[model samples]
Target chain A: MSKKWLSLISMVLAIGMVAVLAVGCGGPAKTDSTEIKIGGDFEITGGVANFGKSTVNGIQLAFKEVNAKGGILGKKIVLVLADNKSEPSEAANAITKLITQDKVVTVLGPVASSNVLAASQIAIDNKIPLLTATATASKVTVGDDGKVKDYIFRACFIDPFQGEVMANFAAKSLKVKTAAIYVDNASDYSKGLAQVFEEKFIKNGGQIVAREAFLAKDTDFKSALTKMKASNPDVIFIPAYYQEVGLIVKQARELGMNTPMIGTDGWDSPKVVEIAGAAALNNTFFSNHYSPEDKDPHVTSFVEAYKKEYGQVPDALAALGYDAALMLIDAIKRANSAEPAKIKDALAQTKNLQVSTGILTLDASHNPVKSAVVIELKDGKQTFKEKINP
Target chain B: MDSSSFLMQFAQQLINGVSLGSIYALIALGYTMVYGTIKLINFAHGDVYMVGAYIGFFATTVLGLGFLPALLLAMVGAGILGMFIERAAYRPLRNAPKIAVLITAIGVSLFLEYGSMLLVTPQPRTFPAVLSSTPIHIGGLIINSQQVLILGVSLFLMVVLTYVVNYTKLGKAMRAVSFDTDTARLMGIDVDKVISYTFAVGSALAAAAGVLVGVYYNSIDPLMGIMPGLKAFVAAVLGGIGVIPGAMLGGVLMGVIEALVSGFISSTFRDAAAFGILIIILLFKPAGLLGKNIREKV
Candidate 1:
């Protein structure tokens, strides 16, 4: 009699698990007309949690400002957040829950390009518009087939633009005749920047003296730096995250290879200075979305407002996050509807929409055409160098 | 590449390899010594190294201690944690099957990793600089002061460990216990105390390596032990498990090979070369470079 009861309980558990899975996977989420739900799939807890937290903070600030002004279409906007854990697989799950369970009209976030790509499929499947703030890889908006992903849009400039900006800066501004490219092979963002930098540098009549790749989480880079030092390039383009970049720069300086090292916005975090030390970062520069030191009234106001809200200066990710939220809210106002299809149409038609970063205009590829700022490191502090317009 | 530059590059990479190998040697000593006495792999040894690094970080940053003090504190802290782990986890499973003990070791490793992760979070912390890293140029090859310090400290510890293992009364008791546990117990040498001493000494050495690695890399994380632990285990096996001198040799060889692979061949295959060497060693010389093959009486 006890054995029969145990088997029956096991059968019930199996059925219950299946039922839970069904409820999780299958759903047309209920729509509440009183408030518009916007999903946020963020990297709230992993390797790039800082980036995720900054982006969410910026998005939340934008929503708070919007809600204070009576929101859009007589409905207050609510942000439903899910932590992606800074992994691509977790990003897919986050987006799935946001769309299938929360029934949000639009989704924002995930700073890394690879994560945006991971979550894009879920949004496309659900026919909900997805806007990424800081994912700059070109393929985020366009698929590999060179077709625009209809349901996907971004608020930041593409990686090609950043690469071209740095390449032109290296050749025309710095007047470096030869360059070296050291990239992180693990990150698509790094590879994307390296490829374009190489092409544009060679096109500008500069030579690439050395090309080396290192995987993420590698602590020792002395051997690779020694190899690069032999070629003796004018500058090194390390298009990797700040974690590895800090070590690479530190080792390179220790090996007496003190040429200017340039990178992209991935080096915006202050931890780079902490790891590499201020002296090693003296001649380094990186392109970013916006500079907190910009004297422009729009930028100044945003910087002051962010400092008031978060009690710290907003980084590039936070600025881009605010811009993305502002763009999405502007589209909702233009479309005069909370429907995802209408929002996507209005987003595609965005023109001269002034944001925290710059005047954002959506291009044919669903990418924002905006200006980028170059920042230089001096004594471990970021200084505004130049702003280049597209 | 010209001959002069080629020679310089070779010399540079050699220095790099030696510095790196010394760190592996420090971790490998713990694995070999623990395996020598108890015959358990003690997979939690690497996590102890990681815990040592955190302790060092806290000692330097929170307690505001200098380099030597922080290093000594971390060594003592990790040593106590090692004893507690052995008592609470391994001692209970002493009479169990080998597989059961190994599984328990893996479980202990996971618990430490996740538990530390919960306390510290998954974010990687930057280790505070305890020493100047200015490079010294000599004969077209650059060597940093930190590298010199690592080599010096590791050598001193190895020498101390060798003297303790070879010339001390406790060393004799340890050898007897390792040879035959029942015989040693019968001879009135408290077998459990000897084993615990082995663990404490080995763990202290690993903690030193952990603190040194944190200084060298300028980064520390809770899960930092997983890869280095496996690599040190490989080093122990390659050097002849349960042998003191062999672990040191195996670790240095592994480090040099990895540096050469990264320098000449490719950085991508560096990790692959380590595991590949393990397979080759197991197939060709299962007794390892210094291990003696003992036939089991069945």
Candidate 2:
């Protein structure tokens, strides 16, 4: 009888311990707040951690600056951060947790377009205002109606504009009459950019000698590069992320296909240099949000501050994240409330706001009509080339 | 496509397929050999390949070793890692159920993959150029010198392995142990030492394949080995598990078939074609290509 009583006590203790552990693991619950809360759902750990880390740094810097000037509407802005680990499913879960548990008035994040697509449905269902910083896919905001999304906004310019800019530059600036495109068929970003570039280049009276497709994770490009070389194109346009782009560049060089290469915003990564040696990367061009060489006082100040804090110049994603946060703060101050509906309304009216990238004006599709700068790699340094206006 | 261009492309694709097949054969031998001796599928074998690639990467890029020295170091490093894995993970469970060892192998694989990702950055790194950069042309076919080197090395290793398994004293001991561990032990063979040696050989071959593939492809990532490892496993099973020559045959056949499917049919069905062949083969030949049927004792 005493042994049975002891067993029962132990069982009760085990159950209590499990319950406490469960509660501890669960995220903090939403509480009545005099604090204006904003949640960031980002990939802090995963293949794309560097991109996520840069955006988080930008967001934190903006938050610190805003809070220092007396929090939005005299209420201290509380930032809640969650790591999504660069997985689409995790991004969805993080957004749901941010909305339901944190009760954040607004959300900023999810750098990848795939992750943004996964999380956007939750934002739409919950009627929460989500402003993405780095996702450039046009379909993220525009639906079948081609109109601005009511609750969704993106700080980056759409792919179609960037793609056309690249194609035009390749033809007129690089003077390439024949081009080849190596696209990652598995990625919507790669496919969309390739389609746009192909169409615009063909329209400009340039010939597309070969169009090759590869899996995103494909490491072998010899066969593809061989085929591309046989076609004898003047330039190769690879519309993929830096991971593949770097290797492709290196392999293409090794194969003696020394023609200049072009890419999109995905080329803005330090890994590119590590993979494609600085010497091999010469003459490559890419379109980005903003270059560090921009002489605008606002741009110079942000560059200086970023270098001071991080000991490195911020990439386009970082600038966009900083701009997105400032935009959110402006909306909140204009609305004079932390209510989601009011902030959504204020964001829709955002215009003529000068940002680190350029003057921000949301188009009908809720994408920022920002200027894109074309950067060229010369002697291992990114030089300011020309700016294209959307 | 024109006719000559089509023929040229087809020939080029065939060469590419064979080059890839050679790498697959190297890895498949490791899988088949381990399965032949011990019934456990060493899922961690792929990570062993990944470790080899990293070793080569560090040796070449960080330590700045020449090509031949870096490769030798990578093989030795991988052999040591393989022996360590056998001692730590598989040794304790020699008498356990096959499923237990299999699960443990998978656990070890995951541990290595995630551990590598956490320790090293998750991004893919470019492998240093270690092979010749020129391509050789023969009649309508063009092949890179690196591809030729890969094929030559793979064939040489396969031949060496076949000889070892057939003639050497260690080989005889391994065969005896695989046939019946209890009888082999009663005969005074050191089962533990033979098993460890099998892992070392298997892992060394996988390491060579890993570094070769990395250099040939010019990119290496943490999860790079998962798909190739799965395909190589299928190749091992298709060729008749336990048969060294059979694994090489199966690997080359699988590679050529995949390339043909991608070249003639659709690139999208490349993976499906490889696995579909395996399923069909399994349905007809349950014991595999060169597999022997063993009657169980009542």
Model 1: what is its DockQ? 0.38
- Model 2 misplaced regions, further than 4 Å: A1-130, A137-148, A175-179, A205-210, A228-234, A294-311, A325-346, A349-354, B1-4, B61-65, B87-101, B128-145, B178-187, B263-265, B283-298
The model with the greatest lDDT is 1
Interface RMSD (Å) of model 1? 2.1
Give a tens-digit lDDT track for model 1, residues B1-298. Answer: 3423878888888898999889889999999988988899999999999999999999999998999999999999999998889999999999999999999999999999999999998778998888889899897889999999999999999999999888999989888888888989999999999988888888999999999989988988888899888898999899999998999999998888888887788777888999999999999999799999998645
DockQ of each: 0.38, 0.21
lDDT of 2 by residue, A197-294 (tens): 99999998899988887788776665567567667899999888988888888777765678999999889777788777788899899998899997
- In model 1, which regions exceed 4 Å deviation? A1-128, A137-140, A143-146, A305-312, A329-343, A352-354, B1-4
Clashing pairs in 2: none
Residue A343 Cα positional deviation in candidate 1, in Å, after optimal superposition: 4.1
TM-scores for chain A over all candidates:
0.82, 0.82
For candidate 2, what's the TM-score of chain A, rounded to 2 decimals?
0.82
Clashing pairs in 1: none
Q: What TM-score would candidate 2 get against the native? A: 0.78
- Which docking category, incorrect, acceptable, medium or high, applies to candidate 2? incorrect
